[model samples]
Target: MRWISKPLPNNDVVNSLSKSLGIDRVLAQLLALRGINTFDEAKSFFRPNLAELHNPFLMKGMEQAVQRIFTAIENNENIMVYGDYDVDGTTAVALMSTYLLTLYPNVVTYIPDRYAEGYGISYQGIDFADDNEITLIIALDCGIKAIDKVAYAKEKNIDFIICDHHRPGDTVPDAVAVLDPKQVDCHYPYDELSGCGVGFKLIQAIAETLEHPFETLIPYLDLLAVSIAADIVPMDGENRILAYHGLKLINSNPRPGIKAILEQVQKTELTITDVVFIIAPRINAAGRMKQGIHAVELLTEQNISLAKKFASEIDQYNADRKELDKKITDEALQQIRENNEEQNSTSVVFCETWHKGVIGIVASRLIENYYRPTLVFTKSGDKLAASARSVKGFDVYNALEACAEHIEQFGGHKYAAGLTLLPENYHAFKNAFEKVVKETLTEEQKTPEISIDAEVDLSYLTPKFYRILSQFAPFGPANMKPVFKATALRDNGYGKRIGKVEHEDDLPEHLRLNIIYGADDKTYNAIGFGMGHQLDEIQQAETFEAAFTLEENNWNGFTSLQLMLKDVKC
Candidate 1:
């Protein structure tokens, strides 16, 4: 792993901030590196305020969307809340549909099938709306690229209000409103909201128009928090505020569906990472293994009993997903070896019978082996569908755009995307993609780089410092858990490989170490997951540098500080 330490702020600024905030110089330097230099900036970073949120009307098309919803409610017209099949989409659908149902009786929700209708606003979904006499459709997490589908809906007298955050094409869908901050024309203060965040803004606008306080919508932020974290959007700006409050709700007064999912977990407080692993997969499993409507049902269900039943079914789906995800990932790796494509700049593999829902995850797993742009293709009807994932400093969406001539359709962000192509064009597209990336990718881009925020001796660590770091809640992209580099680490003779899962075949997949820094008498416990391979190298050196993040571990009813090592080097 390439350890890249971020340049620290100058001593003058760090000293000033430390004096102003009455914090350790190290803590103040961390804030300064994130651009929180002034007293108010630090204050806002620690205590996010809803009033700091951008005005809902500041978005280009938000007013139009609000007016359209008002018209639907006034005339008692049928309104269908449509969303994609992923967690971001389903959560938006749940949030919007539930809020609408509270105000009007003609509201319903819809989630397209990944196998049948594929991604985005599907013609089948529009047909269902037409057959049911629904004249208004609010599409969440999709429809920005549905120019054709939106036009088809328009011919049938169904208007569309799109709440999306994806990059727009040359021309956007001719909807009544397109609330995507990524659009070149949009001037919303922060343009990095998730699909669910956009959906929340629409509801916020509606509430304001109805003379309701902003607190009226606070209950829905738990859904917003999960969507933001799972979708991997930035945690800076308004997103941080939403996540901050949403986490509070998650720990204090979560919805029935969320509470049902948390019933068996024993964590006193769950972080954003916990939500991504424990909650998101279960919600996403409903859409991946079956239909996302089940997710919406779980989130919107009023009765605790019914919510638990839905949660139980979704849990089974997650179990099934994990099995398929693992099996398919192994198969994709084997395909790469058989084809002898290990040295290629891209990893493109396919299977005719692979489960379509797990292709995206398989693409991610492939990257651990290849460390480059990857695409995992699976048969979708007559055509082949693929999920694209890219490394940092690489734009997979732009790379896909370069090969768009061979693609039937594609849409997503810079890091991840989805696409489909003809079966005959598979080999050609794969070759073309590899060529494009080989000519364009820089040498430094291929190696996995671990960015370190600061280099500090272990002696500087204190319980007081950890307490201040814990306030950096709701960490995600742009604002992440600060990574530190510690050198001169010597094991306290208890360091060894450990395994707790049977699937690991009793072979250690993790390293548990009790180590002292330099001549310090204190020792710290550290665990490095998937880093058992480093034991041989570490034993040779016996003293090396480690890049890690500070964490609190609770075991056997006792809590203590632990370093979550990201990488170790000799």
Candidate 2:
């Protein structure tokens, strides 16, 4: 792992901000490095306000999209809300469909099956809309690259309003309006909205047209928060504001579906990370294990009993998904090993019978071991569909675009993408993709990076400092939790492994230790998960250092701060 230190800001500016904000010089320096300079910016960073959100109308094509939707509602035309099968896609479907149902009765929702119809706007979905006499389709989380599908829908007298955040193709789809900030002509101030964020903006515009207050839409933010966390979008600017309030709703009074899922989890309070790990997976499992409609049903279900049943079903789906994912991941790893391709320029593994629902996740898992551009493929009907994930700084979508000749269709962001090609073209595409990565990528781009936010002494670690850091809540892709580096230390003798008095065959030993490290030599205790193997190493060492985050852990009616170690070096 590579520890890359970002270039720091000038000392004079850091000192001034530190003095003005009444924060430590190191904290101020880190803030400045992240482009937070003025007190107003600092205040906004600390307290994300709903008032800070940009006007929904300011987004390019938002006005046209809003007018088209209002026209459909006024004419009482049958409308279908179409989305992908992932958490973002399902959440967008739930949010838009539920909001529309509250105001109109003609709205319906549809999510394509990941296994059968694959991703994005499907022709089968279009046929269902046509057969039902649906005149309007609001495509969310997808449809940015559905130019042909949009044209096909147009032939059936159906109009489309695409609310997507994926990177756009050369020509925008022939739709009523395309609301993707990644479009070159789009001028939305923030370009990192999750799929559901775009859906929320669409609903916000509709609410504005109906003369309803924006507060009427606050309840839907929980869906957006889940999508934002799942899609790994940046949590800054308006996105942060959405997540901040959305988390409050989750903690205080979540909707029936969310509450049902949270009841089974062990955590007392959930951060954005917790939502990503716990809630997003269950929601995504609906899509991955079955159709994404189960997810929408779970999110929109009003009855507690029905919601609990849906949650329980989703939990099972998630468990099944884990098993299938593990099997496919292990097989892919074995394939790479047998082919002696672990040291290849890129990692491309294809299994004709692999479960189509979980290839994207398998692709992501492959990156952890290979640390290179990866593509996982499965048979989808006569063609082969694949999901691509890339190392940092290398744009997988662009590389896929470079090999467009072999691809039947493709669309996604810089880091992640999805594509389909003829089964016969898989080997050729794989070779071309590896060549592209080998030629274009630098060696440094392949190594994983651990970014240290700042360096601090143990003495600077305090409850007050932790509280200040907590103000930067709802951390995600762009706004990450602060990681500090502390070095040079001797144990203060407070270190000891705390566990049960006896050993049982089923129960493994757990490590809980207190140790002091730094120039000041202040005392602190640390908890390491799955680190019992390190007990012997730590016991034999006289000095050690670690990169960690200070967090408050509460157990058995007592709350105290502890160090959550990321990496330990002795």
Candidate 3:
């Protein structure tokens, strides 16, 4: 693995901020790297305020969307809240549909099936709305590129208000209003909102028109936080403020569904990482394994008993999802080796029997071993559907766009995407994608790299320093948790390969260590998952360099600082 140190911030700015804030220079430098150079900026970063959120009306389509909703309510029209069958989409549906139910009684939610109806807006979904006499459809987390689908809905006299974050096509759909900030005509100050964030903006606008106090909307932020965390949106600007307050709500008083899931885990205090791993997966499992409407049901349910029952069923779905994810991942890896494609610039593997629900997870797993742009395809009806994941610095969306001739439809962000093609075109598309990646990929982009924020001595790590560092909560893209590098580190002889093997034939996958730095005589506990193979290398080396993030470990009612090891080089 390549270890890259981030460029040091300007010394003058760093020193000035350190003196102004009365903070350690390392903390100031970290803040400066995150664009928090001024004391006021630092205050906002550490204590995000909801008052700092942008005005919802500033969005280009806000007025139209608000007017459309007002018209629906005034006319007593039956409205359908439509969303993609994913965590972000389902949470947005829950937030919007629940809020609307308070103002009007003719609102319902729809989550299309992953098997019968594909991603984004679908004709089948529109037909369902038509049959049900739903006149208005508020689509969240999708519809940016649903020109044909939107046209189809318009013919049925169903108005659409799209709240999405994905990039738009050459021509947008003829909807009542499209609320994506990615539009070139849109001048909304922040553009990196998650799909649920866009949905929140629409509600914020309606509340403003009704002169409702902003505090009344605070209860809905819990859903926003889940969406922001699960969708992997950047944690800065408006998103940071929303997530900060939302996390507070989640820990202090979560909704019944969230509370039910939390009761199953043993964490007293949860972080953004905990939400991503614990709550988001259970919520997503409903969509992935069975039906997304189940997730929405749980999120909106008021009865604690029913919520718990729903949570239990979703947990079973998650267990099934995990098994399928692992099985498909192993098969994909074997296929890579057997097909002699291990050396290729991209991984493109397919199996007709692979589960459609877990192909995206398998695509990510394939990257762990092959460490390149990867795609996993499974049969979806008569066509073929695939999930694509790319390494850092590579835009898989653009790469797929280059091979668009072979694609029937595709849309996604820089790092992840989805595509569909005719079964006969799979081989041509795979070869074209491999060629596009080979010609575009740079030498450094081929290998995964660890970015270290700074080099610090172990002696400098005090409780006060850790306290300041912990304020960098809710970390994500552009504002990640700081990774520190320490050199001349030696592990005590007690270091061992940890974690139990499922079977006698399997090997342990984790490493545990008591690490010492440069004869300091102070040992710090460290654990590295999937680093068992490096135990012998670290034991043989006199000293090694390690890249890690500081975290608090709790065990048997005792809490202590520990290093979450990312990589170690001897």
On residues 1-570, what C-alpha lDDT tens digit does candidate 1 reach at each position? 688888878889899999999998889989998888899999999999999998899999999999999999889899999999999999999999999988999998999998888888999999999999999999999988899999999999999999999888889989999999999989998999999999999999999999999989999999999999999998999999999999999999999999999985656579999999999999999988999899999999989999999999999999999999999999998998999988889999999999999889889888987899999999988899999999989999999999999999987778899999999999889999999999989989989999999988887777888989989877999899999999888777778888776774567789998878766458899999999878777877868899999998989999888999999888
Candidate RMSDs in order = 1.7, 3.1, 1.4
TM-score of each: 0.97, 0.92, 0.97
Question: Which residues of candidate 2, in runs, are more than 4 Å off?
Answer: 266-268, 401-409, 425-441, 491-513, 518-522, 528-542
List residue ranges in candidate 3 displaced over 4 A.
Answer: none
* Model 1 root-mean-square deviation: 1.7
Winning model by TM-score:
3
Per-residue C-alpha lDDT of model 3 across residues 14-38, encoded as one tens digit per residue? 9999999999899998999998889
lDDT (0 to 1) per candidate: 0.92, 0.87, 0.93
Model 2: number of clashes? 0
- Residue 443 CA error for candidate 2 (Å)? 3.1
Show the colliding residue pairs in model 1. Answer: none
Per-candidate count of clashing residue pairs (backbone under 3 Å): 0, 0, 0
| Top lDDT model | 3
* Alpha-carbon lDDT of model 3: 0.93
Ten consecutive residues with minimal summed lDDT in candidate 3?
A: 261-270
